[model samples]
Target: MRAAIGVWRWRRNPLRRTTDLVEAWVALVAVALLVLAVPAAGWISGTRTDASLQRAVQAQTRQRPVTTARVVRLAEAPAPGTQSPESAGEQPARRAVVATWSAPDGTTRTGTVATRRELSDPGDTFRLWTDLDGRPVTAPMRPETAHAHATIVGLLTAALAAVFVEAARRLVVRRLTHRRYRRLDRAWAEAGPDWGRTGAGS
Candidate 1:
């Protein structure tokens, strides 16, 4: 609909310039890409993202296992306004503590793990995730979370694509306008030398 409105001059306009026809074609192409190509690109991006996330979810689920750990002692919480190197980018809601758990092979292992609750004494049990070596690990990725991520990625990709199309359209129009202006200037210069001369007006 928009393309039809934009290209109306090309159908039957006696006064239309070459620039008008070129711009009408450009507008039609831009509209086609915005309506068709943009959505296709977004869908492809989102599908790829979802597939990659699902693969990661599978890998993490296979490598990490849930286990119970006994807290040997609570590590000192970070000082106010300061963060530990290990806790960089991690939420402050959880604190690190020393704990011990048994691996799948029935061998005992001890390490520092993050816990939601602050433990004051030894032997306090807490739920934890561990790798095959009994080392503490982050929880596995959820499918719902992956879906949300994919949705955001798709939306951002579509928006960026639209912006690019708009920019390209504006660039083409500006170039066309400049060309028209240069042609007008040349015509005026050629005609200026004959102004007011006999038979020039005729």
Candidate 2:
């Protein structure tokens, strides 16, 4: 909070021109937004690319020779464990796969589909999702597909942009200093005359 206050105060530095401060403020905001948006954009791009890869794989799998094909509803439960007929001991496991598919009408659907689970019941929609290499792969989501990592390059870009903006401001100070020096030089050349040291005042 104190830092925020300090920043707010710094934004209003009286020593700086209004235009310079405004430029600095705008550049700072733009750089900050770019830094924040890069990771999120990367995540989205990765997920989209992954989806595309799955589609390519699925298309290739469809072209391959198949032993059999069956349509069943997707489930969120694991395959049932074999139980001894003499003993009543059976347990059901739960595991889901993330699935998505396009329909005949060009509509897309995505949901959690069970992997190796029991056959789907009535009205259960089922679709296949494959990997990039045309193999019957599992879910569409990858461990790192959604993982966003901030790297040194992103930070450096923002830092460099900010530095450029600040450097632009130095030009104004340079011009002001040049004018001040010219005034001082003119005054120094007339200093003796003003003192009437050699009839200069007349």
Candidate 3:
């Protein structure tokens, strides 16, 4: 809006220089791009990102399966000061356990796994996610998490587009200003010597 007003006000003004008109036009173009192009870029980028992430989520889900493990005994706890929040908690969150389960290959597997249960005796069971080889793996990504990642990428892309447009506009304006200053200096130099001459204006 300000850019439009500037162009309108300078369109017919007698004192307006060529650089002023060009600057106003540049501002208007920048405003147009900011209004139209930035959102389009963000949307396109986000859509692509979401599609890719969703595909990855599907692949991970198919490759990993949940299985039940019977706890043989409580695994040795880490040192009191060395336990991370994820590994240390009195409540039922994530506690280490030595357990056994059947692998996809029909063989028995045993390892120290993390469980969200308070282990008191052997034979306690918990659900665990493992790959085809029965090696433990992290949970697959959810649709909600993919959406969140897409949103962040979209926002960053839009912000970067805006910054680029503003920077280009400022660079053009700065160059025009420098040209105007140079013209002003040349005009002063041409008229300086005759300024105080007798009958110079009469």
Candidate 4:
């Protein structure tokens, strides 16, 4: 739509200069790229990022297995009003406790695990995730979360592409303007000396 309005200079008009036609063509090409290239770049970036993240999530799910562990000992709880800002919104703050669980090879392993409940017993069972080495680890990433991340990356990429396109268009227009000014200056210099003559006005 914008390109349609800008290309009016290319229509038959006695007042239009050669530079006007060049600028109109430039605007047309810039508009074409803005409409075609930017979205293609964004989709490609997003799809690749999404695939990579999904693969990582699957690998982590396979490497980290969920196992049942018994709480062996409870750690000291934080003092009142001592919670960090990041955990302040969490209800019934989680506490770390030393726990023991059996590995895939039937070997017993002990590690600290965070629990929302206050566990004082020696045999309270809870589910936990463990890496291949039987070390405690966080849960696997959700597919929805990965998709959201990919979407944000795509939008950012598109925005940056748009900025670059506009910058390039402005640079081209500036160069055209400079060239037009130089041409006008030369034309004036050639006609300036004869300005006082009667026939020179033509």
Among these predicted structures, which one has the highest lDDT? 3
For model 3, give the 10-residue run with minimal summed lDDT: 78-87
Q: Estimate each model's TM-score.
A: 0.82, 0.31, 0.86, 0.82
What are the Cα lDDT values of the candidates? 0.81, 0.46, 0.83, 0.78
In angstroms, the error of model 4 at 178 is: 0.6
Which 10 successive residues of model 4 have the least lDDT summed? 78-87
Ranking by lDDT: 3, 1, 4, 2
lDDT (10s digit) by residue, model 1, range 1-202: 7666868857678888899888888989999999999999899999999999999989988898878888888766542322334345655566667778988678888777776665525888877777788776777877888898999999999999999999999999999999999999999999999988999868
Tens-place lDDT digits, model 2, residues 1-202: 3334444766758775454455445555545544565455555555665566556555645553222113344445532322223222222333344444543334554544443344344343344543333333333333333232223334454566556545655565566667767777898887945774666656
TM-score, cand. 3 vs. native: 0.86
lDDT per residue for candidate 3 within 21-67, as digits (tens), equals: 99999999999999999999999999999999999989988998878
RMSD of each: 3.9, 14.7, 3.8, 4.4
Question: Of models 1 and 3, which has the larger lDDT?
Answer: 3
Candidate 2 versus the native: TM-score? 0.31
Candidate 2 worst ten-residue window by lDDT: 82-91
Clashes of each: 0, 1, 0, 0
Candidate 1: misplaced stretches above 4 Å? 76-90, 118-124, 196-198
Q: How would you encode candidate 4's per-residue C-alpha lDDT over 1-202 as one tens digit per residue? A: 6676767746778888887887888888888888999998888889999999999889978998889989888856532232334344653656767789988677899766676575536678877777788877776777877898898898889889988988998998899999999998999999989978987767
